[model samples]
Target: MTAVFAAPAGPTASRRDTSPSAVPRAREFRHTTDRDEAIDVITEVYVPHNLVLPTCAVDMTLAWTPLRHLVLGYLSYGAESYLIAPKLETFYHVNLTIRGRTGSQRGAEEVETGNDVGLVFLPSEPATVHWSEDCMQLAMKIDKDGLEAELARLLNRQVTVPLRFDLALELKKPKVSSFVRALQHLRSELDEPDGIVASPLGVAQLEDTVITSLLLGQPSNYYDELHSSAGSALPRTIAPVVDLMESEPDNPRSLGAYASVAGLSVRALQDTFRRTLEVTPMEYLRGVQFDRVRADLLASDPETTTVTQVMHRWGFTHAGRFSTNYRKRFKELPSETLRCH
Candidate 1:
């Protein structure tokens, strides 16, 4: 029942792959020999399920990297298994068995997944799965609520119908392949200790990109509406707020204040921002402040000026976070900017 949320700190798994597609060990890791403990580990990431293992000796390995809107996991039961789970309720999962094979059934739909082939499990259906002795699955859990909310914001209207996706996920298709590649890129880039996603802007942008791509490219019930949505008009909706951010780089405003300027509710303003700029109003303002801070740092004499002073003038109070964002945005540390100047 040992679960390590950070990178693995124990002996290595000889079979673990170093490929970019694999969620790095630096993600959350868990391994167990006890049957109940193994079940608990699985339930920790997913909903409770009835796990009928053929043997009393259970060995399971679980690894996951949880993000703001989704969770990426790798799971393997080193024995034959059958699991019956209730309606997913909250999340939609895409399962790809990278080793051996898996059989899944929901209602009348049945799928055998292996290698590049995958099956999408909708939130509305109960599921049953059979895992082979050597099976290892790259299980991706996407936040259903967040995804639906993204779709609504993009179309700028309420979504009355269930967002059911086509069960078969053809990974070989150019669009699906590109979406998978983007997730892999996010895993690699965000796993670093001081990765670019440390900044609010980077996090918002990546999360938005993931949700938007999935909604647009995946065969969903909302396909036609998404294609016809007035997403182009969103830029105009948020332009006033952006103008305010640019005009008053040093001014820090709450979400409500900014929304008032845009003549929309706080929620609408935030949604419009993600749909248009892939970042929130606050993140955009922070980026503007960083630009101003960099300007001050470059023009001031290093002997008389300080990074802290310039940062405070731009309303950046957190030294470590500010430096990380500044470095990511400018490709160098703020001190480096001042030193070189």
Candidate 2:
């Protein structure tokens, strides 16, 4: 059974329905004879596979489960075909061959993947995948934004750059192999009639699990940052302080208050902040406060909201120093910003 449930069309879309049966049921195509129809269907739901069909009759089974921000597909076809995708710019495809063999090329690197070796296709990379007639693959598609968001959460930072992944996955390693096994288990649970995935919470948890597993198992650009030992505790400890500063930038803050929020002594907090962010705790706080003040200055009516009002509102007691810092950060005078806006 191929389950391809179209997620609701919005940012907060999921497959969960009060009546579970109302959810889009899985569909399967067994021994599909029409080559053009197969190509069209696969291209629409899956990636565009400019399939090179053999002269012999095409026989294949295609089944997929499309959950929120993720899709699981199973394909077993006796017809040889090549999956030619120049760039998968939206999602990350993790192709695991359950039976038989396949080969893929991304750039100059080409290798054969079978039951042992899984293949990962990132959004930034182009791929040329060729599968043998006897190949049966369990394919997983992860939404790009969801995965990146998860990575950012785990790393305690905003991911401003594209995440490029390693193409070939050697699943012999315990962590990699465990991630594949977990994926298989989740698929089995979803396949059941009364599976937990019928609930919204279940779907969300499963999405998180898949994304977290991939982040931990796969190597990417921020891999070193995640696994780094330097100031490891600082990032976690300072996260709350950063959140507080961002959320309530105008609120009066001091090193002692931030230290309490971070559950560290003032001295320890200062040292950690300097090590992790190369800025003192007060310096970081000042930056956030300045940003808020500048936003107000830019958006406010100069007639109603003066530089003095904005500065005092954001806890800047001095006019000259505030102007100096604001100019340094925005490369423009606060007065200029207010006048222009």
Candidate 3:
């Protein structure tokens, strides 16, 4: 029970020719206008596995006018011998397996991509693909910058780190099914009269929805040190403190209290902060509290909540100090963030 899915003909290409000179070169594959020619060039450069590729169907559509966008592709391959170009380009890719087992090797690590996992690949680096005997994959490609910007907004911080292509997170069955349904629906809309106008919007919404679900579904412990690794020396110690200050801004804990909880002497913590994050612990805490206050003010109903009320709620007791810090952190006055309605 092996299957090999073929790429559709329209404006696409498959790998074709190879020569001795093209073997395992350490250079990126240049972008190509001719899809088929590019595929041929790629197939020639890489070594193919000798196995019977399973049975699968693949349908792909490219939106090249506004931006480079790939609609969706479904692939199921049995035990088949095929060569995947070592270097593959993508703006961004989301892949989920529906059945069987598939594995990808990046650098020195090998990761299994299966029905229980969803993987995101960013445009930072090129990677090679390999699969097991029986595997089914559904993938979507999208604009890298657009996806990054939207993720930053949702997370309320910059999120431009490269995705570890080999990393795998458990995917809930509901999300896998929902993504498939959305892809099918998007494909159907692509063939309609107003398909052009509606398809892009639908795709954008679907991308956002799926991303949101994935983020919310991630284990909290998984992201506990997200900010700690950004050149922060005391990432282990400072990360939790920052999270705590942001989550409980009104707690009114002093620097010493935080240091005690972090199991560091005040001076040791201060040195780590300076060495790692290039800021004092108090300064970082102030920034965190200000962010919370600003967010709270922006989310509050102005008709029901006052600016001072929001400020005091987050431990900004000194109006003058609070205003100064708010302006410094957000470049806007506290009054400006609140909703007039």
Candidate 4:
């Protein structure tokens, strides 16, 4: 024989107040300060919580002046109100939950935000946030111009897209996951004392590559008419041709000669150029030469460097054309850049 215990009666049984019942109570840590030094210390401690959700606490500060990128992290007690004011910085933001279940209330909408959830916010936009106990989140601030330029390159058009996430949507797509991982890696490297000094060029390249990948994954609806229209697909062997061009910017091979080396006809090579890069073979070569010239100018020892010496080194047989195009691509003249530095 077994005795039966009655379920908790009326009020408790009928109630739908899950915040208290479903979530365990936890203490919230808040860091509010007007001091820059204190804020920096807090940011250093809190920014790493992006790796996992429901963190114990969150803190962050921006030491990089002009704030090219800003990251924020927050941990909150379950079922508490939080507010964030608008700032003058114009940047895109990505918010991610690393721990504990959480939700955000925006304007007239209240949505459940969790470990797998992420949201993007635009510059100068203000919003309030609330979270349940044990909730942790990472917020990244993206440079506005940098973001726009990246997206434009990917879609090949200008765009002004929205910043909210749909509940039904899976925000942690493969591309998104890769981006988050890359960001964490970059942040870690940047934090190292001698990291920047050791590999500044590599760091810059990685940053550019990550930004390009993210821009490619953005919503298609954000693309403009120019981007919507399909351009000719690049040739399968185009990579080899591009590699050859980069490796030998000073190669004296004619278009026909290069085409023969790549096992393609002159016309076929021209088509590949037009379709893939939207530039002719000769035009691309000129651009490559210019890049090499610029790099040498910036990095070479000035003691042995001269305008003509650098120009000839990059296969600029014609000073007039090189100077003309250099000015066009980089507004302030090559000499000016080299001289100023």
| Model 2 spans > 4 angstroms off | 1-31, 231-238, 245-341
Clashes of each: 0, 5, 20, 11
RMSD of each: 13.0, 11.4, 14.8, 12.7
For this target, which candidate reaches the highest TM-score against the unseen true structure? 2
Q: Which ten residues in a row have the lowest lDDT in candidate 3?
A: 58-67
Model 3 has an lDDT value of 0.50
- Ten-residue region with minimum lDDT total, candidate 2: 9-18
Error of 2 at 1 (Å): 26
Residue-level lDDT of model 1, residues 1-341, one tens digit each, is 11112232332234444243444544678867678888887887877898898765556788787777678777877778887888887688877766677889976798887666677888889889998877777777887756776876676543446788887777777777767667666667766758877787787678778778777777778776677645434466677787788788787789899999889999999888876666777877876687688778878999999999998999989999999988765557899989985
Q: Rank the candidates by lDDT, best first.
A: 1, 2, 4, 3
TM-score, every prediction: 0.61, 0.64, 0.40, 0.47
Cα error of candidate 2 at position 153, Å: 1.0
Candidate 3 scores a C-alpha RMSD against the true structure in Å of 14.8
Write one digit per residue (lDDT tens) for candidate 4, span 1-341. Answer: 11011111223212312232222221222333223433344335322111121343323211221122333333333323243434323455565665545555434545666666666554444444554444445545565545655554553322334322232223566655666566566555554647561575765665665565455444434423223445322355665676687689887578888787668999988887776666777777776777678767777666677778989887787877778888866555778757753
